[model samples]
Target: MSTTGAPPRPGPRPQGPQDAGYGYDVERLDPRGPGRMGAAGPQRRRRRRPWARWALFGLSFLALAGGAVLLYVFVILPLGFGTSLVAFTAALLPVAIVLGAVWWVDRYTPQPRVSLIYAFIWGAVGSVALTFVIGTPFTAWISPSEPDQVTAQFLGAAIQAPVVEETMKSAGLIGLLIWGRRYIAGPIDGVVYAALIAGGFAFTENILYFGNSFHQAQAAGEVAGFWQTFFLRGVLSPFAHASFTALCGLGLGIAAERRSLMLYFGLGVGGLSLGMILHALWNGSSFFLPVDPANPLGGFLRYYLTVQVPIFLILVAIVLFLRWRERRILRRQLAEYGRAGWFAPAEVDMLVKLGARRKAEKWASRHGAVARMGMRDLIRATVELGMERHSVLHGKPSERTRRRERELLERITTDRRLIGALTAPVVRR
Candidate 1:
């Protein structure tokens, strides 16, 4: 990482293009160097167009308004008295837990907070609102006859719900890839954003399901319905939406780096299709066997054992693999930058290991709160700089990327100086 201390000595530049074997052109490695690929000076910043600013504002307002309306319709209107309170309280535990898990998995490089919030809002409000609009009429058209209500329910769950809900949910991720391309650097980022969006959608959906379950149970003089639904949705399958949408996220995340239009389209379509299939299978599981009211959770337990558990295990394996990939990429990219004199070898080692990073933060805390915070920012900026460098090497390099690289380098320098000044006395003593 760049620091206020003397910069590392630059290695000998490759003598020829053929000698540049670190996957990036040797000539274009340093933006500040005097070479064919070097910037003559800083690029001028462009002012944002008024229409673009207004569009973002309009979208934000719509998201907030829609979320408020849904909260009222789904939670408040349907469940009066204390039911709404109980439902929201029960629903939030799983959402928080799942969100924390996703956030933790993104340890290598955290995403922009604004992008994460946008994704969650899009899923919770925009996706749900659109789903309600499109699904209600479609489901109504396929509503079963009086004698075949069970068949209609099955069709709605297996076919209609998956098609509509998965598509709507995946749309949020798609939009993120289009509008916030820089936020998603790899598969792990894709998973993180997908999980957040999915968690938000599940939270809203659970409010409706749990609230209705509670209301019906109270009417029938049984309180078990609420707890049972809670256990199933909240405890057992909180990651249902997340796992489904992760497939789509993985596709779009990979697509972001691709130059071929065909490959991008293929991956995007394949991912969305896979997510829909998984969702359909999950929803359709209820039709495979009969449920005994006496054994209220018998059917669900069987499905959970046979279906949900295996899928969840698979998702866990995939997540672990992706996390490992992210770490490897960080190490590889940062090592390249280190050799190119953007970071010292010791700094690359510290940045690559979570243990080392945590220890650095702990040491900084002994100096003061500000030192600790500065260390954290320095670490994050280092990782982000590595990712940007990786993008430049593997994908097409652009002027914007060169500018971001310069900005990140400057941030690392500032943060390092702040933390060093704060901790200097402690270190000397």
Candidate 2:
């Protein structure tokens, strides 16, 4: 009788290019033959696409055009009011604060500087311009000839502005998901990108609001309007747009790491919807629960203590959870790569913990800046390799994925060699 036992262990399966050792020599295993570039050949060609440069040029032109329009409206037009300096200064201070917070949060694995700047420009110029264009006509059309102040304000704040502004701000995140998907590794990336966009949007919006407040205050012969507006928009609610857009960013980030089209679409829609709803609630609060105009500060305290403060705390909790998840991902994926021999087990331990990573940087700093930078690059490449592997296993791997994997391995080797060479002299001395 034919035996049903497991066939005598077959000869070891032939190692393909990917199964080759994680060293520079692994290129010899390329299925395209020893001299050919293999998976990276097509990626190099794709990177040279002529359309990308043109697209970048188009975006730059749009940003410049939008900025010109906004400058006319917010700065030049309001010049006669005599508060241009105060308005610009007030607008920028909060932006600086928000940017500092964002940079600190993204210290572990910062996204590309160019991508971050693009997000900010999209929010500041493109989104703001689009919103102003659409919202002005819509609001004007909806207003009654003899408008009631309460109803007009309620509709504009609760319905019109939230819908228009959130939609416009989210366009930037959507663009990133489409064109720069690789940059968003997790929810934290999304939050960072969203925060940059929100900061930019707030910057431009503040310029307009502050300028208007200055003009109105001068017309009424009172300086208090400018300060009151600054206190509310600049100090108290500068992060309002960021917090709202972060919900959308969180959704996009989750979707980027997933493979299912339905899940992606659902998360994107849900995130945008949630942001709009929260924005509406915040804006509508002023109308439903009218603050006593006589005691504006007291009313603001009451409203903030009850509503905005709680929402801010919730956002803080979400950020902490996302940061924890980032650490967990780094640990789990690097451990798997360690087993596969891509990383030393000890190296994985150092890379996974923030304290260990910092210690490593300090050690490298003693060698020289070149060694320090090499150490940093090695750590980043190793982390990226782990993330790429995780993404491939969880979703569908692409040609770009293979190329990236190969590039990261090469980078890790080069960086390590550089660091070793730099430290070798110190050790001998």
Candidate 3:
């Protein structure tokens, strides 16, 4: 076997646009590229006391919840918690929904829960905390001289918020993508992390907006300002966080997978800058410009959110569909590996889809708990083995997880040996 658990001589069998079972020839038809779908071994099962994992999960959850609340109250809330409660609540609700959706959907793969929490912390910590260090003086210097005029707000919102805010918020994902690479798979993973960061920033920001709006309305004895902020910040474009952090994730995904020289740095910095620019534009664009509200080009809110929002949704859908398609590709390529005497056909079928594996596990349970555990191991090994063999067929370079394929293969080989030695096959002749 070649290094990293993949067979060296076989080369990579790149998956293309096709359904599963194009036969073993799928390996022969793959096109080579910089972005190879390298394989990852399923998390190995360690037979320890069950409470160990539970304890770790509890500690991580506490850290995430406690950290965000602390940073918000002492740091962000002090700065602007009295700003706008309504807007804050509105913004906060949707973000919580999105995060909940991602967490629920990605149950098959054990996501890096810690990294996500850290990403959110990075947004809140960097946006408000670092802003105090770098932006406070600038704000102090500028606010006193200006008349709190439209010009001043424009400069602060458009110029400072976009550049400083996106950079600060995105830093968490960038750092994680670089340091905690083993946890990150690609752009979709990046989106999940960066979006969490963006959501946190939005949450803290909404506190200020909401509190301020409440006081402003109470003073005027009118809710127009509250409604305006709600519509502008909330309904007009609820996806502001998703947009800003998405670029960062795209960059991280490209860098993590691609094998280009400039691409690594280019993707990271370029994506961050892009996110900042978009944020800046959102800040700069005015809701009530000189033009009539009824006019075609009256406001950017009409153009950006209305026109661009649907486009962004479409793009997200496309990317998700591609990932799903890729999974199907892997299933087919791996099914071929089942024929090579490396793994059993039943094991391969179990991993072809999530539901099928659960069914097989139930069947194994009929024998005993040990057999069920062994079946699970067999399922994971077969899945990983197919991934390695596909890489071999396609000639892709080694990735972070691909590096461990060998250890996985060794376990699988050992398991196969155990099967042969432990149970005798009846002779048909």
Candidate 4:
């Protein structure tokens, strides 16, 4: 039940290296005396190699193109123009809701827009495209010789779909972790990116389901079927995919923090495996429910209430805890900067709380656009600075990290100067 804005209580001073789950000695950090980084002196800017960026951009383009082709062939051709359009519009509602929640969770330490977009595209287009490429043929090959339609559908939904879809989605996570390493500062970042990808996948998948249901209902003269499908998928279980994928993201995030290659693989596999299992169980539940003539959906409804609802609630709790943990990290790390004179204690307090940060930004708006923009950038950079320090303290205490620290310090200094100059007292001679 930790809250984002609750002020951190004072704790015992660090006695040695073991503190905050890292090896770094918080005591050893130099204050803002002469020749210290707290002064934010000029430093050399390092130029990042562009190959990863270019390669990622190129791959995203191909995936998007391929996805468009698949969309036209599979969804549009089968469902017709009007139905597809309706499905597309209907599909947007849940996607928007899920994406908004993810975005809100990520607000503490906002990631780069480009990276977020890449994650979404990978989920929406790349994963779906790959699933189509592999799933159709593989499913056909594995089809049982005994022609039991219900059994076949159950196998496809419970077995093939989970394995194929989660794997394809995980590929995107792996790519992001490899090429866009800087974007994922911790577990929350991992969740944010993973959820975005899931949101994208769900969007396209929903379109197919809704379109098919719409057309099928029309043909069967049972228009209620489409609405029922919408209620079940759209309202009742929109976040199902996101919850599953977030476990993988959580693993990736922990691995990123630990800076262990083995963990990157081990945890990634472990998380993906867990996700697949959960997905399978979720899909399999409906197939195995005992038929009750009195209440046809009694079993499914009970399972949804007892199993699905609790899982979703638990995931929501975990996300909230993680966000609160993020706030704590910012407060702890920024307190050290405060002691070093890089920031005031009041400023540190303002930066960690969402409400205070918003008020500060709003207050700055009265001074004009530059001040407001400077405030926003300063908040973002300050959060980044704290996260970078957290990353260093975790396991990556390399020279590159040191360089990033200096860069952030300089950027913060420049922002402070810009904002200060705007409100500084003018002297008239």
TM-scores, all models, native as reference: 0.83, 0.81, 0.65, 0.86
Query: What's every prediction's RMSD, in angstroms?
Result: 7.6, 8.4, 10.2, 9.8
Q: Tell me the spans in candidate 3 whose CA falls farther than 4 Å from its real position.
A: 1-70, 73-91, 104-110, 137-148, 259-261, 287-301, 304-306, 342-349, 352-403, 410-429
Tens-digit per-residue lDDT, 1-429, candidate 3: 346765557643442322121122222223332124454447554454747655654664566567667666775465454453444566676567656655643434335566666666666555556665666566556565745676677767777677667777766665665554544555556666777777777766766676677678878999887777766666555567677777877777655545344675788789888888777766665634455656634466566756567757875784577458546755676655544433345545657778887876786566567666666676666554554444344444555335556567566666544433333224522
The candidate with the higher TM-score, 1 or 2, is 1
lDDT of each: 0.77, 0.77, 0.60, 0.82
Instruction: Return the candidate ranking by TM-score, descending.
Output: 4, 1, 2, 3
User: For residues 239-341, could you state the per-residue lDDT of candidate 4 as single tens digits?
Assistant: 9999989999999998898888898889889989999999999999987888798887688889899998998899899999999988898899888887765
Residue 88's C-alpha lDDT in candidate 1? 80
- Between candidates 1 and 4, the one scoring higher on lDDT is 4
Over the stretch 1-429, how does candidate 1's per-residue lDDT look in tens digits?
Answer: 676898888865443321122112232355443122246386678764758845874787576677769768764676786777777888898898888898888766788777788878777777787887888788877675452778778878988888888888888877776665677766778788888888888988888788788888889999887788888899988899999888888877776655345756898788889988999988888777688978857877887898789988998998998788778888988776666666656778888899999988898898889988988998999888776676566666677777778778778778867875675544321
lDDT of model number 1: 0.77
lDDT of 2 by residue, 1-429 (tens): 559987786553443332222232212222422112234554343455858855974776576577758766764565654566667777998898889888977877667777888888888888887887899777777787877888788778888899899999988887777775676766788889999988998998888888788878989999898898988898888789999999988888787767557866898789889999999988887765656668867866788888889998999899988877777878887766555455656678888777888988898898889888988888888777766566666776666667767878778888866776676544331
User: Which runs of model 2 end up more than 4 angstroms from their true locations?
Assistant: 1-77, 80-82, 140-149, 365-368, 426-429
Q: Which ten residues in a row have the lowest lDDT in candidate 2?
A: 18-27
Q: Which candidate comes out best when scored by lDDT?
A: 4
Model 3, global lDDT: 0.60
RMSD of 4: 9.8
Model 4 clash pairs are none
The per-residue C-alpha lDDT of model 1 at residue 64 equals 64
